[model samples]
Target chain A: MRYMEDTLLHHLHTNDTEALKTFLFTIEELPLLQVFTSLSANEKAIVFRLLPKDKALALFEALQPTAQHHLLRSFTDEGATEFFNDMAPDVRVRLLDELPASVTKKLLQSLTASERDATNLLLGYERETAGRLMTPEFITLKKEMTVEDALAKVRLQAREKETIYTLYVTDQRKKLHGVLSLKELLIAEGSQLIADIMSHEVIYVATDTDQEEAARLLNEIDVIALPVVDRESLIVGIVTADEGRHILEDEAIEDMF
Target chain B: MRYMEDTLLHHLHTNDTEALKTFLFTIEELPLLQVFTSLSANEKAIVFRLLPKDKALALFEALQPTAQHHLLRSFTDEGATEFFNDMAPDVRVRLLDELPASVTKKLLQSLTASERDATNLLLGYERETAGRLMTPEFITLKKEMTVEDALAKVRLQAREKETIYTLYVTDQRKKLHGVLSLKELLIAEGSQLIADIMSHEVIYVATDTDQEEAARLLNEIDVIALPVVDRESLIVGIVTADEGRHILEDEAIEDMF
Candidate 1:
């Protein structure tokens, strides 16, 4: 298991912060996550505090919710907000679901308006449904848009969207009509309309659709992303394959405990 | 849990093959899998027998291996050979790993030579590692190739390759150089060399690296496929995100049991 309590832990105890940072940086993220689990609560705190802010945030977000709760308990309100607010919407929702009601309420109040709204939308949907697991930051393009125009739109909007791997084409009313992969867009003639080349067979999930079924479809089809829609059949968010993986893993962890 | 015992089960009871096939056609694959789980032993055999050959193959491959074992017991050796030889490589390996040594031997003998070789390669590695989960059907391209050339290669090899989302470029001795997404290739000028456009941060797993760790890396990075390497850092096979999701789900099911 490579559970060797080597000089790296020794470096943390010896108060050699420089050596400790160097050593920790050399270890990959998953192994680092494991290493933190093995430390004394005090040792964990000491080592966690010594990490650079970016590394600490990345490592903290990767942790299971119970471990995250323990770490959050040690933080002041401002410290907690900074850490919690930076997490992906789905992960943030999961952490909030686990924390005390009062903490969740306060954390909700502390978030930026948009992040708070997205989390609320996900939470409002019934648990164990696609709505609860979707990320709200999805890009929607018009069905009539040219491939050239669509690619430009994606480039401009890509940073805010969770995934550009798969894009949806909706009518003016936001009803999803077709789906296109970024690969297809890149390969198409620039003058061709998205609707001409996009696959009209829209494999999607409704807001209240079962999450396990969604995960199964995502895995079975091997699509990098799938669109989630509300009752109006308007696109609301995306459930990336990566998030699908996390949902399955989290459920597995739940089974273990 | 839509556990309605409706007229479809009625059709099965009455031996109404036409009605049962018609009703089953209206159901989706995932729900069909769940329905199969609820059937009694004799009922399962009757319903499974009524399915068309293609539908039967898909349904059988999606089943849990233990359930598959039960079905195999009821089949003639010739019938079992037809069913066992058609599963995806990793799924086949997993089934082999679970069954009695004698059953595994018989199935391995019945497989095509190429499929047998691939199975042996994956089995040669320690279980619960990237090697065990990876499929050797990945498409490789050279760093010197133009974007046009690479895309052409992808189209020709797409049917056999596990994933076309991410492609790796290797040097003369098969030493890994960099990675480029198909999206990047599609958007780039067709004449550009792959080495010019690829990212140097090659996220990969060694052959004996832990499977859970590999799954985590694939999820965290949101990559559809990852390179699996031999001891000298040569790419041997690719592990797709689909496999990553299954590995996590299977582990979760194990924990629940």
Candidate 2:
């Protein structure tokens, strides 16, 4: 840890963004988090700012809400606003819930309309429900689409979606239909319709389901992500196993406190 | 658990092979393992024989060596030979080590030359070392290969490989040079060289490294698989996170006993 801190310090002093990016990105998340926690607020800000945008977003998302809030406090308003706007809606909501009401309001106002709406959509759910923790950023496939077309759509949305490992299939009306993994898609014939290949028995949760229950379902099924649907059975979002683990970790920490 | 057992019994009574496959495959592995454990030896054999070949292999791989041994004893010599031949080399080695010397030798005789050689290769390594716990099946990418070629190779080898989630970049002499995820390969331009996109800093273990330490490194890196190299730095095999977890679990169970 000390070696890492010293290496980072040297990278900082030398202004080596390439080496710094590689150094920071290559380190394991838990160890990196420890290093960040060990640094002063100013040092934390410097390190965070120096990270490439994607790496910064990834590191920021890995942080607990409390750590996120503390780090956000050290950033300039512009930096803070950009980070808030860029965060996945579910993660942004967690951070917003940690901030003072006025600060939350200001941050929410700074978001683009789409992001603000997405954030508000999540906020509408009960605090401990699956809906509140799921990211709305997911690629849904139509059962009629060929595997080739579905793969194209997945690749296009891969940058924005929370996960492409597990894909959900739906009708035009947004009714959940089937689920298939990326590996399945990769192995299937390109001309095959998604409905022909996808498993009809998709294991999923309703929006109102308890977060812990949803996490358990995710773990039980051993899939990358679990779909969350509304009362109408309209697919709304997906909760990743990572998010589920985080929710459990946060719950455990709260219990400890 | 009772409900699951009842469902399995119903499937078996009705002789519903298709329905049984769906039922067994859809259930979580942990719960399914529990159900298997609770069954009588005859019932277990019946249930095991009913599973689709692929699902049977998967379930067999998930069981601890003791459970695997118990299950194997109930299988006919022909069934046992086929199962032994199909299993990943590392897993086969573990189960083989548990059998009495004569039975192990007979089983070894039953294996195809390739699988027999692979098993022998792993057996040569010291117990509780990475070499003894890594599957020899892995896809390696050359640095000069285009992303398109790499993707094609990955798709071609996906089924046989232990994991397609992490791909290793290696030279002609099989020296591991870099590493990249499938996601990275998917997102990169088709014309780009693998060398340009892969991370030069690969996290790996020596073949002789302690199994527990190798598992720790795999966990620390958060990759699906860790490449294992020989003393001469030649890529030998890969140890997956699932295998690492199983090793840890078996160790814990051993400690308890």
Candidate 3:
């Protein structure tokens, strides 16, 4: 306990706005988040002001729409711009979906051209569809690649990808063919082609599939991730295990009440 | 993913028994547990054989009385002894609560003295109360320690305890006083005393409180854990966030169907 406390004190003393921002952005601690939510508006604003711009934006995106509106009203124009611009397109769409049309219009106008297009595409989808939850970040793999080459490709693009754990295999036209895990590549003989080991017995849901269905499929299969495809069977994104677990947890809570 | 397939194959080959045991024990994934009341004798026996001895016992204990009787008749003497010996006292009590006195007497004869005593104690309580779920695994802390010292106590005892995230504070009389999080201790100054950092505004459910009430209290606070106490405010056990989340998810699934 003493060691844990000392380490914590050291981090606290050395912590800057960047570290604090990162912590706030990826805050998985529900109890702390609840406590923060229950704080006075002024207190929340003070905490918000202390966070880095990007962190503030991410944290704002994660907040409930009602809380977002309350916090937005407190922010200056510059803060609001930073918050809206830094948020992911899908999250922004959800926030817009909840706001009055007038407010959403004003908020949409604040986004960059690319962001606006992304937000609009997501907003066009029905609520609770795969399209609404899907992120645009994914790496597509060519089926001809050797296991070593595929691993190299993953390593190069891994930083920007949502998950490198499961890689989707595609053909010349980028139509989904199979899925592979990084673990298989590292242990297999490097000479072995990805085509030899790729799981052709692939399971996926269409982009228009209901999120609940996607969650159920993931749970039933016990896979870490599931690919999301289009009508043409082209892999677009992956719905991660963590996201599926969160959906399950939320659904469970709803049932209990 | 080729990599995931290889890793899964490797795991499956190396740990077949453990894997089979895990599959059999997870009631959350299996529909058979819910349909036990309708299963034929041969069908029940098939499912029972797939389970490890301990889990078979747990599943047997969890069954409705009529189902238990039908299933028990199918088991050989060795299998019945293994099942009876491994069953938890609280579960055994629930089984006994619904069975006829003659049958209950035969079952009680199979239990060890300690198991029988525990069964009797739990049977005296109302169903679904804190006393039923309380497993006597909680670690209590004296309120006089510094935050650093208190955290050390948690680390030393964490492995044996059910949850280390929320530490229950107690007085000289061993009555519950407050609760503290490891997160709080990490951020607080080392010189700070336990009372200064501890959250005295703790919310708890009494021994007689319903499971739904306990679940609601956990949800309302957004904490991953809650302490259960008796009427005199003595800490009995802690209900973890994961368990609460599971309860909520199960309830949601029930509503969905």
Candidate 4:
């Protein structure tokens, strides 16, 4: 293992992209984290660039906030903006919270207009609130959409959405209306109207609700994502079960201490 | 509230099934638990009988083990047998563990042949093992099946299964082959073969693995269920995420004491 690490480091220093790619080809998540962290920020950037986009995103997501900050600094401005923009809005907010004010401002300015707006919306919320903990990248179905139309919409945008498991149904004003699981849509007849089958009893939290409370609700309800609404019952964002688990884990650690 | 409770109890004592049915018509899971627990075991059984089948199942599932046992004792043998048979194998095992040995034997004997076999398979495993924690009620796809055929099979059996979110692929000998999520199946063309889309690299636990370890793996993978395999790699059962979360919460509480 020591000799393998030395050779990998040598390859990194020498820019042996071929050898580094070969080594990284089958590297699992845990070792990838170790290798990424052990390298200097520049070296980490070099190695990260060699990774395929999906793997790079996965590695970036697996990283600690400090490591993520260092990796971001190592990237070119264009690269930084693109990579940061690709991350879920909630993740971007968490990272922004850890950075110095000037760096955070620069990064925020670098985001795409839509990404910047989403981040800004989250940033406006108080810390530890549902607004700060939700991802704005969610798919919303119009109540009038046919099942086929909804499925098509989900398929077209599924790659970029935070979760396609639970789709929220919104009205003309984007007011929270109803919710249905993707499975519900999949099993329904194509011609069926979404409004006819979608559940109107949506369990949701206001944007200002405590994040821990939101997470507990997620657990109790056993839903893939909990919709976070604004004051007017407009669906603003969603807190996923995975994010809820993290908050619960963090609270557990805090309790331990 | 006291007056309402008194009226409800009067209805229960008078065996006013019509009034009890009306009362339970829109009762939610939490309040049902409260009402079920507050009643005498015999009264609980009467109220339970008045509930719709789905609601009764849900209420029984939501009850604490002690409450479940008390309610079970109040049930007539035929009703107990029918109800016991309807539960997923894993849940039956958990409840059996809490009962007196004679009661456990009676319940086991009351199960249908298939349900009894499934429950016995789970009961055979040591406590806190993956085998003991998994439900045998999972849908398995054949590698050669067309996606359409698989979907049909899932739809037909979906009601009886513990979860339809994650489906395991198994070979002729019932050896676990690959796995895929329902979303994957729904997105793919009907003509596509399961072999082409199912992920060959399945993350699973051996039958003897610790339940906590299995639950942690389920959390890490963020999958709906984790397959548990026996010595010959035969897929025995699966642990759903909801069960995993319960195990995790129980462990957290255990730590606090």
Off by over 4 Å in 4: A1-118, A121-123, B1-123
TM-score of each: 0.46, 0.54, 0.35, 0.54
CAPRI classification of candidate 4 = incorrect
B1-257 per-residue lDDT for model 4 (tens digits)? 45556767887666554576678766777767766677765566556655654676577678777776666555543433444455565654443322222233334434554554444432345568886676667788999999889988886776666678899999875688999987788778889999999999998898679999998888787888998876567776788888888898899899989
Lowest summed lDDT across 10 adjacent residues in model 3 chain B is found at: B96-105
Instruction: Find the 10 residues in a row with the least total lDDT in model 4 chain A.
Output: A96-105
Q: What is the interface RMSD of each candidate, in Å?
A: 5.1, 1.1, 13.3, 3.1
Query: Which stretches in model 1 have alpha-carbon errors above 4 Å?
Result: A1-133, A136-160, A183-197, A206-222, A247-257, B1-132, B139-160, B183-197, B208-222, B251-257
Give the docking tier of candidate 3: incorrect
Best by lDDT: 4
* Model 2: CAPRI class: acceptable
- lDDT tens digits, residues A91-194, model 1? 54433322222233333334454554444432335567886677755567887899889977876676555577788888865678999877677667779998
Report the candidate with higher lDDT, 1 versus 3: 1
Which lDDT tens digits does candidate 2 get at residues A153-221? 877777755587788899876789999888888888889999999999988887679999998777567
Which candidate, 3 or 4, has the higher DockQ? 4
What's the candidate order when arranged by decreasing lDDT?
4, 2, 1, 3
- Best candidate, DockQ-wise? 2
* Angstrom error at residue A217, model 4: 1.8
Tens-digit per-residue lDDT, B59-122, candidate 2: 7778787877676555443433443455565654443322222223333334443554444432
For model 4, how big is the iRMS in angstroms? 3.1
Where model 3 places Cα greater than 4 Å from the true spot, the runs are A1-257, B1-123, B245-257
All models: lDDT? 0.65, 0.69, 0.57, 0.70
